[model samples]
Target: MTELAIGHVTTDCAHAADLAGFYAALLDRSVDPGATEFFATVGRESGAHPVLMFIQVPDRTAGKNSIHLDLHAPDVAAEVARAIGLGAKHVADFAEYGAVWTTLADPEGNLFDIGTGQA
Candidate 1:
């Protein structure tokens, strides 16, 4: 069988550059050059899958996101604070599975989580 890997994960937004910029700052990834208002990317496109990609859309995705990203941080609270500073809104907090995590919405309302890895 041919090897399979995710080339990129894309999300649609009214303006690609805005969403891409948010993720890039949040993930500490670099925005690829030549990005236009219609499309943009975070992370180096030359190597690997580039991790994330964004495309412009007429309307935002409706309802809750069917898929979301769960992030890990040594200090969940501090990370959450930083994310909020970066324009992420705190959605809620969860304590289960022997861990604690906080859900946040990006500038475009895409959901993601930040958690304390150890107990």
Candidate 2:
């Protein structure tokens, strides 16, 4: 038998409140009240289980991000433009191994890729 289970993923952020809010707006979900400085979860019970945790880290993001999220978009090109207008900047142009994808970074320098379908 094959059983698949892994713990949730959390991203470290400098400000819990600010980063939580950023994710809330980006994900279009309300922030979980249980969220604190050490942790936060978006879409807590909506099946996304996508939690963006904020831990008190001294370092501000500099250079390339070691970890990043890949957000699926209905329209990769349009979403890339929209995200850029919303303060996200293009880190790299569109590229693909088998699907379309674009690399972008948030205002806080967290890197994420937006794409349509599967890559």
Q: Per-candidate TM vs. native?
A: 0.88, 0.76
> Residue 111 in model 1: shift from native, Å?
0.8
Clashing pairs in 2: none
Report every candidate's CA lDDT: 0.84, 0.73
lDDT of 1 by residue, 59-87 (tens): 77698998887778888888899999999
Candidate 2 residue runs with Cα over 4 Å from true position: 1-4, 34-38, 45-47, 60-62
Stretches off by above 4 angstroms in model 1 are 46-50, 117-119
Which lDDT tens digits does candidate 2 get at residues 28-50? 77777777765667765565654
Quick one: best TM-score, which candidate?
1
Total backbone collisions, model 2:
0
Model 2 lDDT at residue 32: 73
